[model samples]
Target chain A: MSVREEQSQPAPVEGGSSEEFETERASATPKGGEGCDGCDHRATKPRRKSRLPALNPPLETTQHWFIEAITHPGTIESGMRKAQKIVGRGRVVTDGPILDAVDRMRIYHYAYRARLVECLADDYPTIQYAMGADRFERLASDVIDALPSRKANLNGYGRVVIDYLQRGPGEDGGRVPNRRFYADLARLEWALVEAVHAAPVPALDLPALQAIPIEQWGDVRFTPSASLRILRFDYPVNRFLQHFREDKVPSIPRAKTTATAVYRQGFAVWRMDLDLNMVDLLDALLRGETLGAALAPLEDRLDASHVMAWFMAWVRSGFFATVR
Target chain B: MSARLGFPDLGIGIGLRTPHYRHILDERPKIGWFEILSENYMQTEGRPMMILDQIAERYPIVMHGVSMSIGSTDPLDTEYLRELVRLRDRVGARWVSDHLCWTGVHTHNSHDLLPMPLTEEALAHVADRVRAVQDLLGAPFILENPSTYVEFAGSTMPEWEFLSRLCENTGCGLLLDVNNVYVSSRNHGFHPHVYLDALPMDRVVQFHVAGHTDNGDHCVDTHIGPVIKPVWQLLRYAWKKGANASILLEWDAEIPSFDEVRADALRARRYLS
Candidate 1:
């Protein structure tokens, strides 16, 4: 299952009902519902009342509670209540006047949200620019609420964002303007990010390609560089990103199929737009089709000169790792 | 002071931040070393890794990580350790270090160095993980004290006691962040000196000095701007007590020119000399 689908499942409540947990938590605190002010002085002082009955829930349950609290989009109090249900209020004790267990949880909640938003913003700058900061942060928060980060590296956190956007903003309970354009922009940005970090590969040298016999050229297969990525979008995302980088607020172009290839060469990332025929040829090559087979399908769609020019461009761009 | 664990006192260094990359590559300034955030270069084969490769050739580099989550309840992530060792070997890092706190529970990563409860159970749990990490890396794993905003009621002892005991148990070394010592002391209402004094000097292999945001009631280890007066004093104190440990200044936010940040890191020379 996709990460989005997996995360959509309701968080499991481990052993007991929420009602029973609430009752136990209520009984642990003072009848007046006013516990110690969560003061450091109070923490140091001996507790007159026996420590609230410890609830040693399973480690996963505690972790779920902790993660749920930080990822929750509701008020801090609601997040705290969720945490208190699993770990008990006593487990989150703090030593400050203004900050209680709930307040401490709130601090963490904000920190987590900030980190997520920062990661998303860093990874998808074009989307952030297109959506504006406030709207982008809201969208980012919704994404975090829906899908808590599942990877150890923050770099791996936002790959599912494009998928999340495709599922539509309805899951986030808010409507986004230019949703399709925004999604396309996100795809473009993520593609560039992937291209930038993709593993390095040695480009096919000219001598190796030239040594192939003319008859065997038809049967030759090509391996694309690790950083090569082809993205097809409804909008001219390649041009949009270019305009965005130039600091000109270009109007979102009308709906048109645009295919772009992003790759890294000499430790620098580069992008280029491609025609439908070229996209088809590259896609065929990516699927491990022989050079003749990949070109045969496009024979009627392109002339020999155009095919030769595109092939030379691809080679010059260092798109292929091996030609055999 | 004698160097501990045979790790050299690489003198003063600054964190190799992105903002200073061009200047660092161009000027090749006279700096002691550069501390690379391991996670920044671990999963990427891009510009950052490329730049790191070039920088490693010029300077003494050490690998510091934030995602080790050493104190988490989850099992050790061997994949991360493997990559860490690879990076350490690639860069010829002198040591690999991460915070002595968990980044998250479960598999989810909050990416913040969340504090651990200073209980005996937690101490044992963290020590075992550190030992495993050390075994995997085939080197003494260094752990740093994180700046915390809250203290758990479940804590059975002070932070220093837990760290000291953990070092004793695992034979791991410490990266004493004086700024974190001061920040946590203020937030938790303890004296920084008392916490510093309680630590075993011989086990300390490094020191971190950084600036923080003073929020009236507490300070946050923001690692921005300049290192404050008190934190510098604490650095001097740690330098005197501990052996000649490598000291690094971290400036992650609102970074200025390379010379300015390097100058801030160079201030440590006055105290060390």
Candidate 2:
């Protein structure tokens, strides 16, 4: 079901005078109100009553109150109940009637939620396709409730989904089917997105690397491109993503260790699956290790010819920003 | 008619969207100008940015954003403004614009343009922010009237009055989105014509025309499909009132071919001419 349909309608609250409602709210604070309520202090602070003192102070006083109430990270009905206490009844008026005012607030509340969900859907298209529209939207809504967006950019909004899913639905008190696989998929997808938008760096051309003396090869350290990302997962997410991109409904493969590198080349993002040894070498190179040291650990396990081929392939793929 | 800010009317243009990127580059159709979503190309080194560089080289571009949050109580984001200035300078944008509403508070971004209370207090607050932004940008900052679903009970005046006073206070310009005016009017039961007539027509530097989804009693500003007759009528009304601002068609969802969207945008010329 759509989020709008899933949410229950807000019930109208009893109308009261501003002073009467303020006194009632202050009394209802549970005296101590024990320990923070875990709400963000910045978000839930009491409205500043002294900011504006007009004949109708309720409207001026309740401006931020209404915004905070509707965007309270809770159900719409609860938000309305909290907003009602701050503004009081019969004091709030709009160009439209009171009922329209209530409906308008509801629309804003739903629109905020809808936009967040839309961002998540765009950032994680593969996961959305796998989970289907309804299920993916439900998951997106739940993730949003747990971790509201703190950045001005929507592109940076859903970075926590992978970790959130890894926590195994503990918050929801339910098990998500194939939870591990889904988490891995989210990791790969998000990594690609980050790689695509990361800072651009000029790749070190083959001639530049060849110009270095043979004696300096041992001390030469390679700088990985800013758009390079090395991801390790327990599911074959790279293969799954390939099929998903091809518009085929492929079955989820059995659990298997998978290591992949995602990087941008010529303004296009590319993904490559690598063996365990190659993953280790790439990881070391990404950490600013010398070419000699990056290959030393894999020397005994792999043939010399294979190592040289891998090195040449990485350079051809434009993964190194510089070689010094 | 020249805008008070002296921004030239670049004639009818369309929003540069992703689906039409390949077609735009390959065909390079005859167009007046392009309005780019500032946030889309900011802080990115992706294909979108590359394509924008190519497009900006040939077309007149304007930067419109949603994250400026001008009405928020939070301190202005200097970093966002700096990047906006850089992007504007890089693209040689004619003007930079965002909505006259807050996107979030307390460092959180709702990504939706939330409504503002139409009061003297909000007017002063927003005017100050607009002046600061314009100073930082070293250009005239333009603001579009958002398609608001809710009207604040605390609003002491109509939206048109608040906008007019804001323009006067800040010396900023207006984008005058006619579809948004129509959408808000129907949602709040006001006359769209009165809303347009109340505006300072000379201050309008641009115009936005888009389609919306009409859901019985209320309408959602879904930039899909074609511009409706009522909204086109509103655009015509604004045009006759001497708002000779640059007109751009917005189609963000279910986008058709470039030819189709261009044709849709070209429809405005009939009313303007």
Write model 2 residue lDDT over A132-172, tens digit each, in one string.
99899888888887778776666566686876788846655
* Candidate 1 residue-wise lDDT at A64: 61
| Candidate 2 interface RMSD after superposing interface residues | 15.2
In model 2, the clashing pairs are: none
Worst 10 residues of 2 chain B by lDDT: B213-222
Give TM per candidate: 0.88, 0.87
Question: Candidate 1, B8: how far from true, in Å?
Answer: 1.1
Q: Could you list the chain B TM-scores for each candidate? A: 0.97, 0.98
Return the TM-score for candidate 2, rounded to 2 decimals. Answer: 0.87
- Every candidate's CA RMSD: 11.0, 13.2
Please provide, for model 2 over B221-258, each residue's C-alpha lDDT reduced to its tens digit, 9 standing for 90 to 100. Answer: 77778999888888899989988889999887667899
How accurately is candidate 1 docked according to DockQ?
A: 0.25
Per-residue alpha-carbon lDDT of candidate 1 for residues A74-134, written as tens digits (9 for 90 to 100): 8666776766777765555453543445555555666667766777877787788887898
